[model samples]
Target: MSLLAVSNLAKRYRRGGKPFAAVDDISFEIGPAETLALAGPSGSGKSTIAKLVLRLIEPDAGRIDFEGGDFLALSGAALRTRRARLQMVFQDPLAAFNPRATVARVLDDPLRIYNIASRAERPRRIAALLERVGLDTSLAARAIHEISGGQRQRVAIARAIATRPSLIVLDEAVSALDVSVRGQILELLLDLQRQERIAYLFISHDLGVIRAVAHRVVILDAGRIAESGDARAVIADPQSAVGKALVAATPKLVRTSQDAS
Candidate 1:
């Protein structure tokens, strides 16, 4: 079974007398240890799809199944607890964290909130999580202001993985970092995914990074699925209008990796 499944997801915002669809009839899945990249321009409904599956917003219609449980069917504490198996790495790390909290405290918050580990176990897990995301544990006691943009992003990613989530939705997670740092974080994420058998729903505009990781690619346009298939094939020879645009916008000298093990 797919580790994460989103079927016919639809979401809309009502303004004036008409409604505007943010995500329309989108369906896809991310398999165990697979990276699926959703690429689209701003307002193309890419992030909206992330919010829907993550339960950050209620879907107007659709089914999001994670490990045989339909998340759309869950509610209240059950929903929250069930959803903890999935985590999100936001586009802006600084915005995701509470500035008042130190790095260690920020990483520990979710463990406590989810009751995943005892208070005594929180510190060790927090430190390990920080290290997993390529941060030094000695920096744990420092506040958010004490870190660089890249480091803050690492902390944000560490917090997401702290609970050992099976599926992680990285919504433009590396876009805000410098190129070198972004590559390092991307590699770190891929290494973790390999180690943990994690599924990644990576949303981004940078096709280069997507090429580095994604096994499958979904292209969205005006809130609709434009094209999707094997990452290399679809991105190489696009057949739709939106797909053509994505192909054009993609970097010409893209690096290709083949390890279909």
Candidate 2:
């Protein structure tokens, strides 16, 4: 069975006082240690799907199952317990963190909340998490604003993996970074996935980034799925108009000299 399963999921909101569906009956699954990408233009409901899956907002209708458990049915402490296995990293890493807190405290919060470590043991765990995300132990003493964009993002990633979540919903996690930093972050994520066997629900509009990391791709357009399949296959030959546009918009790398006729 898939590690995460979503079926007929939907959410509606008022736009100009009329009900508008942000997510409309979308369904997909992410297997263990797999990366599934959600790609689309702005206003395509990609972020909404992530929020629904994370239960940041309640879905108007649908079912969400994680590890064979009824995800939508849980509440209060039960929901909190389930959430430990499902974490999220947002587009803005700085916004995800508390400016007042140092990196060590930020990483320690998850371990504390989940009771994964004692107060005395948390510092060691925090340092290990920093190292895991390719940061030095010295960074633990720095505040969110004091760090560079890449470092801040590394902190965000560290916090997400601190509890050793089985699945991480990365909502444009690397979008805010520059090209070089984005490439490094993607490589870090792939490495972590291989090491920890963690599955990813990676949402991004950048087709190139998605192609680099995701094993499968689901294209969303205007609150519904436009196309979905093996990443290389769909990207190579897009069947839908939206899919074709996304593929066309992706920045292609120049071919090597060996490919020249």
Candidate 3:
């Protein structure tokens, strides 16, 4: 069975009394340990798709089935418990974390709430998580303001993994960092996937980033799927006009050759 399957999913809103579909009737499936990227230009509803799967917003129609069970069927207490198995790492880490809280406190909350580790063992786990995201455990007690943008992003990734989720929505998670740091974080995420076999829905506008990390690519255009296939194949040969535009818009794959200087 697929890890996740979305069938005929749709979400909409009204603008000036006109109904607009932010996400149309879209369907896709992801398998275990797979990295599937949803790529598109702005206003294409890729992020809206992410929100639907994560249940940040309810879909107006269709179904989200995870492991053959209906996700939308669960709510309130049941939904809260199911959340531990599916987590999201957002686009901006600085915005994601509370400025007032120490990194340790933020990361520790998931551990405590999920009951993943006892209070006594949380220290060791926090240290391990920091190391996994390429940060020193000593930085755990530091405020979000004290770290580089990259380090702050790592903290968010660490928090997401500390729950040991089966699926992670990396919604433009690496786009905010410096190019060099972005590469490192992508590598770290890949390493973790290898170690834990975590499935990722990596949403990004950067084809370079998508090509580097994704196994399969799902291209969205105007709130609908224009293309979906192997990342290498899709990057090399885009079937749709929108897909071609996305590839052409990239800046000469500078992200890959930036290291040669």
> What is each predicted model's overall lDDT from 0 to 1?
0.87, 0.92, 0.91
Best by TM-score: 2
- Those runs of model 1 whose alpha carbons end farther than 4 Å from true positions after fitting are 15-17, 251-261
Each model's TM-score?
0.93, 0.96, 0.95
Q: Write candidate 1's Cα lDDT for 96-134 as tens digits.
A: 888878998898888999998899888888888887888
> How do all the candidates rank in terms of lDDT, highest first?
2, 3, 1
- lDDT per residue (tens digit) for residues 1-261 in model 2: 899999999999999999999989899999999999999999999999999999989999999999899999999999999899999988887788888889888998999999999999989999999999999999999888899999999899999998889999999999899988998998999999999999999999888778889999999999999999999899999999999998887877778776733
Error of 1 at 174 (Å): 0.5
Q: For model 3, how does the per-residue alpha-carbon lDDT over 1-261 read when each residue is reduced to its tens digit?
A: 799999999999998999999989899999998999999999999899999999999999999998568999998888878888898999888788888789999999999998899999999999999998889989988998888888888899899998888899999998888999998999999998999999999999999899989999999998999999999999999999999999888887357646853
Q: Candidate 1, clashing residue pairs?
A: none
Looking at model 2, residue 121 earns an lDDT score of: 93
| Ranked candidates, highest TM-score first | 2, 3, 1
Q: Which stretches of candidate 3 lie over 4 Å from their true place?
A: 253-261
